[model samples]
Target: MAGDSVRDDELAWLDATEQAELVRGGELTPSELAEAAIERIERTNGALNAVVTPLFEKAVAQAASAQLPAGPFRGVPMLLKDMVCHSAGDPLHGGMRVLRDHGWTEPEDSHLAARFRAAGFVFCGKTNMPELATSVTTEPLAHGATRNPWDPSRSPGGSSGGSAAAVAAGMTPVAHGNDMAGSIRVPASCCGLVGLKPTRARTSLGPGHGEYWGPVAHEHVLTRSVRDSAAVLDTIRGMAPGDPYTAPPPSRPYREEIGLDPGALRVGLRTAVPGAAGQPHQDCVAAVDEAARLLESLGHHVEPSAAAVLDSPAILEGFSAVFGTIVAWEVDRWSQRIGRRIDLGELEPMNARTAEVGRSAPATQWLSGLHTWQQWAREAAALWEQELDVLVTPTLATPPWQLGELAPTALAPAELAAAVGEKIAFTVPFNITGQPAISLPLHRNPDGLPIGVQFVAAYGREDVLIRLAAQLEQAAPWSMARPPVSA
Candidate 1:
């Protein structure tokens, strides 16, 4: 069989499941898959700047190794967002210019990275992200911008923007993404991919640090298919030794949930942006309305309802305090790790301002913020307990905006925060409540940009989200929707 003869575009669209099947069936070797992905990245990344650090030689070598793990996704190529999860001996800058200048590399694989390796994924490279994964836009001074494949002028959404761009452009079948404030789902919304932020601690952050961003952060992948997301979760979801906490175990493997009946669910639809008087962009509102109608068609009951606590003033106040402190901690943590203090002048303006706030804050304020989040979470969770099985909303307040629209270097600290707050309005609340939320590419505007609608379930209810997402994926197949710039 001529495995090497596979067309680049054909390989580009093949999800991890299909790619792994080829390797398993002897139709393609892992080396061939790695080479194909590398060719695509090199060919397309010039425009996208998605894969910032190509690991071509390493990927090829790993693919050819007899010792490669024979797990579910063996031979599939993947990109790691250059934040949180680190691979041994690879540069892990977290989109910081200072770390990039210092030439930092991790000494060991993060538990998540190890799981990816064990699942038989070949690492194509590290993708771009905002500084410290702080901003919703991926235009870091360290690595520049990661452009959307659908529209080069626009952003792909960030912290995981590069990963989302790569997957959307068909440069890779899947890519790692972590979410603290919609980093995963926002990018998925922007890039027209499947982004799932599993319940907090669903995947461990261990051996280096326990909790990131005070438990608001969660890790997962952006994929073109719902099954891919579920399968990947099955591969990586578990607890590691010495972890601060872990999510409740799924009754069955997440992949099993893909085709299972979700049973007619009671879904709440909210088109309005919580706490904001104005509605989301017309396109975003339409996206939710369309998704709600689709859900109804699938035998689910859809109603206009949402957690009232989402509008609480304390939401922003608490999040701001905790976020600021995390920024300060990140700066100090990196300084201690690299054996040098990161001067404020070296940091981005927004982050510098945030760090200052964190430093100036009294310890009681931080604790008070945590208390507010805790109480708010309980209040928000009550909606699921009494009323709805799922809540549907626009993943982002608007469609993908132009690059530099929210650049930290260009905007004032308050200006940047306000802009970012708009994008994160719907998605951030779940991150706070530790619930599983997914963004699905269900609509595209007249301009041809994809608009994603989000469906969130109670904490540790990824199984429910998976079933619904897979049903939607089948109902409105997006696999054939190629971007203008793609592999």
Candidate 2:
């Protein structure tokens, strides 16, 4: 049952946790599983171009030396997205050519990596991403665009697009992804997978800064099942030694949350435009309406509600200042290490533009943005306290776009932002507020592309969102749905 051919087809397609279980149960060995996954990557990665850098040799070596954790996911194979999170000895390109020929990882794993290993995941290698993961689509100058596994004609949503694409193409069951402004959820929406952004600090970000740009970026996973996402969260939840914010401990393991009855939650359903720059696509709106109706059928009280309107310019301006500063810092550190001048010349136009914007930003802009975000978070939290258990919106404002639609050369920073603004109308504010959110694959267009419905909860309320998502998963099973390429 476990062989090279099957690795390319069946084994590669199993969820990461299932592969680990197969290894733990003695149905297959970790070495065999690793080889099979390696084979699948060799066979399909060229077409999908999901994995930019290969680590099969190291993966096989690790498979031989490492012992599987006695957890639910014992010997599963997985990929780490390139932008954030690092493993010892793995080449980290950050999806940029300037960092192309570099190597050197810390002696210890990032908290995200450590937790994934604790969950029984073996890192086969790193996946692709946009340069610096600043863009919405996954086309980095360093690594060519990652195609959607479903059509190859459309994009797998950004930053985590390669990880999602890999999973969609059956190259791996699950992959590590980060979300600050929809990286994980966007790709999941594009590729038809379950993506969850746990509440800020639900998972640790350690061996670096105290927090990731004030919770705008959180690490998560993209998977095929809600249970898998829940299981990973259970393993990863908890603060490490240096977290700036620590979410309260879960009263029980999250695996139990998947099946627990989230009885009669007052769902705040709204298809209104986000305070962001643009409106969602028509199909995205219809998908939200359909999800609301389904929740009604499930006996949940679905009603319209709205939170305080955000100061759009202040939010963007503020977010940009902090975002640009992070980029500048990372670029400087890497440039010094690589012993080369990594000027804007080496970067894509968008990357260069963002760096320039950051450089030009006044210190006051960052301070003001921080204050604005804090004020908005407090105001939004109060509104949530009074009116809703969950806020429903389209995960993305538009369905997957054609492959080169958001190319760096083709679009300026403003144009790209505007283009992405229209599609991802609702994601960033949650990032700013540090709310827990999940993207459920609930609707499909006539062409069979999946659309995700996003459910967001108050800060530190991932348990509530997870429980609710589990209910929705059962009411409308998306597990059997496969992208066209896989089918």
Candidate 3:
């Protein structure tokens, strides 16, 4: 599996699209690509801690397999996010010390994993994340935090932080990640890459499941190129029989959508999300304004508008309840598997808090939260119809935070709420509404860290977001910008 090392000149930290092209054209074999990625991962991951659980041997075996997809990205190397999804023979710790023991995965593959293999990706193993993929920073108890490539002292944003960091540092062209609450987009913003949270159900999650909690998680990839994101989505988007619901399919392939000219769109601009409290940092605001100007220059109509508040104070309180419910369910499931009554003492502080919240919630309160979420979704959908092709906002209210700053144990519940509120002020609303949103790296801070401009489209309108991303990428190219840690 050895040959001439990837030439430095040929290593511009290419995205999945470029890697796929080279591999498909016979310029690079999967083994060579995997080797290059593994080399970079070994060289840098010690400092970054991005690839928390490496499956190098399995990846090598997979890469050496003769059978591979004939698609454009056949024979590419990719990494999986650490939480939720399971890969056969991979020790998935789920980013929690309590659950570090390997769990059983079916002999057969999950649909998503099957699709990845079919796309010719050599699975390079899992990346780090917050416990249960619950938080925005990858500081789980089992594996230490994944450091930001741009600034080692800062977080790369998580639960998909490792995926973002790996791609940003060129350990891989692109990596599979999930967004349950700005997970993908937050890391994309911090790491200066393209991350799209496709419409709910756009990508199937299982052969044995439906929607995850109905509001939050969505499957997608984080990449350097919009085309790469689209290509991955194209391969995975479809509904399995058990899916609760499938998002409307695009008329064309997602990859093709990326190149299609998005005609002048009526973009609604809102720096502040009403009732969604937080003061966006100057850098974050600047990123949004610059994106607006860029859009105007690209012939799109940018109109100022305040985001409509779909949920009031009463409904806003329901979010934590819903989250807690998820925590309790996972804890119970794990407890049963481990043959012990799981005590909150062994869990991370945040996990403990979530479990407490869940335990304290009355059945009536859980139902109320679900009702509020559904009502808000309806209201938000209606508002989108009245105005705006898409909503633009700061992907994050603040720039990247110092490493360990947002550790769940360090902050009190109020402080944690306030901090989370500030960091992802604009993103959670879309997650609640199940709308498609993307983070485009359009601005750089003085220190050269990437700042992302987020554009959110109406529910199930991923095509529109892809088209918009392509337009923005063309207008203000972030491809030329590379982090100092880039290979």
Give the number of the best model, judged by TM-score: 1
Name the better of 1 and 3 by lDDT. 1
- Tens digits of lDDT, candidate 2, 1-487: 2644344466755776677667766878777877777887888888888998788887787667657565667667889998567876667888878778555344567878888877767788889998888777888878799989878899999879999998877777888899988888899898888889988888888866567655587898899888788888888888888777788888888878888888898888766667644556888888999999999998899987765444355556656667776677667767886887688777887667777777777888777778878876777787678888898988887889888889887777778767765555578878888888888888888878888889998878878888888888899988776676652
Against the true structure, candidate 3 has what lDDT?
0.80
Clashing residue pairs in candidate 1 are none
| Candidate 2 segments exceeding 4 Å error | 1-8, 103-107, 276-279, 308-313
lDDT of 1 by residue, 1-487 (tens): 1175577668889999999988899889998899888988999999999998899999999999999999999999999999889999999999999999999999999999999999999999999999999899999999999999999999999889999999999988999999998999999999999999999999999878788889798999999999999999999999999998899999999999978889999999888888888789999999999998899999999899956778988789898778888899999999999998999889899999889889888888888999999889999999999999999989998999999899877789878978888889999899889999999999999999999999999988999999999999999899999999998
From the highest TM-score down, the ranking of the candidates is 1, 3, 2
Provide the lDDT at 180 for model 3.
77
Q: Give me the displacement of residue 26 in model 3, in angstroms.
A: 1.4
- Pick the winner on TM-score between candidates 1 and 2: 1
lDDT of 3 at 19: 76
Clash count of each predicted structure: 0, 2, 0
Q: After superposition, how far is residue 297 of candidate 2 from its true place, in Å?
A: 1.1
